[model samples]
Target chain A: MEENDVKNRFKAVVIGGSAGSLSVLFEVFPALNPRLNVAIILVLHRKYSGDSSLSDLLSTKTSLPTKEIDDKDPILPGHIYLAPADYHSLIEKNYSFSLDVSEKINFSRPSLDVTFESAADTFGPSLVAILLSGSNDDGTAGLKTVKEAGGFIIAQKPETAQMPYMPQNAINNLEIDLILDSKEISDFINMLNQ
Target chain B: MIEDEEIDLLLNDVFEIYGYDFANYSRASLKRRIIRLFALDKFPSFAELRYRVRTEEDYLKRFIEEITVNVTEMFRDPSFYKVLRTEILPVLGTKPFIRIWHAGCSTGEEVFSMAILLQEANLLKKSLLYATDLNPSVLEKVRKGIFPLNQMKQYSESYIASGGTKDFSTYYTANYGQAKLNEDLSEKIIISTHNLVSDSSFNEFDLILCRNVLIYFDKDLQERALKLFDESLGVLGYLALGSKETLKFSTIQARYKQLDKEKIWKKTM
Candidate 1:
């Protein structure tokens, strides 16, 4: 797809990671336009508890409003939604978020695979999924599902990743469209709104 | 894509035919699940799925399971169980007899988890755990009290993390790739089919656990369920929801006090 097509085709962007995602997100979130026209859903594997500081922490870094997702909360454009700890955040066909406390996959609750697969099913070809630095292969099958759904897939360049296993696994298992460093990924997102 | 009108009609058909109300469920979640079911069953469209749902008796049962089934595990969110063990159970132990309701107790994993906790506290003999769900199929599984043996490893880890007092292995016996929970644990549990959306509270309880089940409902249904919980709970009783669920946004928010950071609320009003 052309750069212009990339900006026009997608309705939502899902970013997933685990071990080293927060630092990368801190850099990327600020680079994107505050009023971008797509929903941005993030799943970063973290401890299961009520005292989540991620949404608060991300809100400080980005101009776009950021909040931890509540169950059945509508998915709105130009907002950043962080999946709350201990629940698999799924995208509904009617464009809302649903939380599930089912068994943890890959020993992580907020499983990237669950969210990515659900979002792929919900958004189909209009979705763009990015797999970032992490120690596990949880998001590999999910990115594959996105690819099968005709959505775009990007993996953070493994050589530059803090934890290379996650993105590397995706690249090995799926036809990833791009392998960019953190800065380049930010630049790509920034280009989407131009 | 199924239009809103199409969904509304389909939901109404479901209600009229099966008497299972999906009319007030969160539309987004319900639609997604329906679409998913359609795709999984290779139905041509939502209309086709709806036809089968209305006409076929077997399909209705499967469709209901597909929509309402919540995947759960033993001692999910160890910290919640930790708080329940250390802070909550002791308070309940002081009473003469405790009546606890596990509403929407899917497959009885958490029900048995609670029974184990009560047993360790020496309160099992005096406690009655009423485990209920909207689905009778899952309730049947709950009555058997058998879980796949493979899951025992994960449940054991969760058990230890949740501060189990005895060897977690002692709670079950493994055979034929399945583990049967001890009769002692199962004895305190009474499995029943109860719908939170349509059914009234059958018994008042000192503690009620309606965990991840509420996340599937829309605002109106959520408020209704909260009202039902409020009515069911005794004074100073306890209510526990899923980790992500909260009373903060509900109509009954002010009636309950936060007992822990893990979504345990106590009836204060």
Candidate 2:
């Protein structure tokens, strides 16, 4: 259960957050070692039909390379992948991203639950699910699946989150591993990796 | 019996008897619709529903309604159609002859919308619009080109938002409670039944509109339909989707570039 042990085991990291998530991303992305041999995937809830330039918007705040994943691109270390605005993006065992137009759940196509569950299934114990700021409890069930599969689960401290529905739901749904504010969260993630 | 098994059986029976395939549709939506069908048909059991659909005429009609997801209206998204008119039309206007495919055309409203746009753009004379859907009943209604006259008031507003140049009422004639579209409009369209899931591409087209249709399909089905669209589109052909659909997760995403964020993508080799 050591943090370094968790980091050494995972080949990649997966994070799910929404609503007031940009602040969390700014803190988290810069803390991880740029030289770590691990890829990062972030899922942010977005309006189903709006134009989203999240990857472009995030690129300016982090030194890590960021791009909206295209179909079947191999997941590589030193890069960050952002799911596009309206589709659920999944990672195959081959490390390529798969896009799906399957019917929406809870009226959203790019459901956090879809991305997190699929990632947990694909990566098993190597995966980490984080629920941050959001208006809905979208990632609660998915984060539970990750925890049940012996993966890591983290939530933003509800009082620190701009929208607390998501982090609070994750906490109420499962016995999560860690709950921290943005400052403490970055330090914990970095220390875990080291 | 588990609901999954019952749905599998229903899909099997549909394929075996009607030659229609629902096997590849997203499981959640398909299951929901089948449940609605059962409720509407008053079938006491899944077996009874299957038998009635297999044998009874009235049941088959009801089954078609449940199976076909026709959520559409005239100019459903005004801004998208606005872009289609201002940006897409100019490119389409250059072609001496144009063939457009309105895939998944439901109730013919969108096909008629495109036809009206073409007519105003001075391109209808040299244009051929093929409007297709999997539901034969909807296709038949589309061929008739008559819509409930009451809906015309709302459609007129959409038409204006899409940048109508003339009176929207001029495109159709009111008869009793129905509005019959201009014969000239119908002349430009060929309405037929074509299942995107089970059918192959019929011909190369200058533009293909498969809006709000793929969201009902699973990943495999979406990729199949995307490949079909890619092949069916001629060089520099255009592909338009519902605002909620995109090429981002398809195997062919690299083969397209967003012409507009509103889901207009141009075919790229």
Candidate 3:
């Protein structure tokens, strides 16, 4: 289905990435309308710290209200939540954050695979997953799971990514729905909102 | 909707035919893991994967690895180990016979780290470690007690951070870009295959380190694992979890006391 066709159906949007993710997030998140009813979650890699300042960093670039997710933070519309450093932030049935110190996958503790997989279990088909730029094959398996469970899948254009390994790996393993450049990815997000 | 019961049926078939029992595992995690494997094999359906797994032994091996959680490291959560050395050691105090269980031990990094700690604390002579996991593939590597040299730098940092008094290099001999932990560390270690879900406790221990494993389980499974640990821990035994994990919500939380602020719980009763 086209982005506009499924706009109102999704509960939330989830994006996963690693090494070369900042540029991709810069592109995709800005185009999302702050007024849209859907919330966005970004699971990125960072060192362990009590207060990760990622949401502040992204808020300067986008109109949406972004915040680093805290333990038990409610899932709210028009807000962007970046998974806090050093913990795998998951969505509970009550729409609250459930932080876990689960075993690492793909050598990362706050791994994209873990977040994407957990979100798929929570939201089911009402989820959208995007695999962006990164160096390793972290998000490939999780992307496949999201797609299988009725979620849409998008990948960054590998050639345009600073680190192509992750996008290429996911593209190699699964039939991704869209592969777009930064501007086009922004347009796609706008289209999803429309 | 794939009902939970159908998933249970699939898991049961896998265990009966392939000897890989994941039936009792947390349903959500088992579903995610199996779905991942199903995608990798390009099975048209979960049933198709189940059919092939029943007839193919190699598939069984691959399935075992897929279901098994292998992400671990030496002295992971350095602060926890530091607490173990400083706070728990004097309490243990070189018992005539000390038993330790490193449950869900993946490839044995933690096992070696514990052995080194016990040896340094002058408790090795009385200590025996039962290192276990559901996957036998990694147990073979644990038996060998070897790790890539590339990880040595990180492991060394964790060791020192965990309050090691000896040179990290003193514990291993480098050969062909791999560091083989000295044979002495493996001497008191019995590496074996054991499951937290399907298997019951076989031995009581003075300390049981089961970090980062319970978070994958749902509340019920978490409680189940805690009950097993509660049953397995000797009086006043120490139990450590991942830095983010705690005994707070589990059924056995009342039976244990927080050892330190680092998420270690001690059997209180």
Which regions of candidate 1 fall more than 4 Å away from where they truly are? A1-12, A18-23, A30-39, A45-66, A74-79, A92-95, A102-128, A133-179, A192-194, B1-9, B39-48
Q: Look at candidate 1 and give me any clashing residue pairs.
A: none
Q: Chain A vs. true chain A, TM-score per candidate?
A: 0.97, 0.91, 0.92
Off by over 4 Å in 3: A1-9, A15-40, A48-109, A117-125, A128-194, B1-9, B18-20, B35-48, B94-96
Worst 10 residues of 3 chain A by lDDT: A93-102
Ranking by DockQ: 1, 3, 2
Lowest lDDT sum, 10 consecutive residues, model 1 chain A, at A47-56
Write candidate 2's Cα lDDT for B100-214 as tens digits: 9999897888999999899899899999999998887888888999999998998998889878868999999999999999999888898788889888988999999988787
Model 2 complex DockQ against the native: 0.06
Considering the two chains of model 3, state its CAPRI-style docking category: incorrect
DockQ of all candidate complexes? 0.43, 0.06, 0.16
lDDT by residue (B1-269, candidate 1, tens digit) is 56668889988998888899998886655766776678789987777888998999898888888877468889988889999899999999999999999999989999999999898888999999999998888898899999999999989989998998578889899999999999989888888889988999899899999888998887789999999999999999999998777788888888889974678999987
Q: How far is B63's C-alpha from truth in model 1 (Å)?
A: 2.1
After superposition on all C-alphas, the RMSD of every candidate to the true structure, in Å, is 3.8, 6.2, 5.7
- Give me the displacement of residue B188 in model 1, in angstroms: 2.7
Question: How well is each residue in A80-114 modelled by candidate 2, as lDDT tens digits?
Answer: 88887666766665565665544465566577887
Off by over 4 Å in 2: A47-50, A71-78, A88-104, A107-109, A188-194, B1-83, B94-97, B105-113, B119-127, B134-189, B211-269
In order, the Cα lDDT scores of the candidates are 0.87, 0.79, 0.80
Highest lDDT: give the candidate number: 1
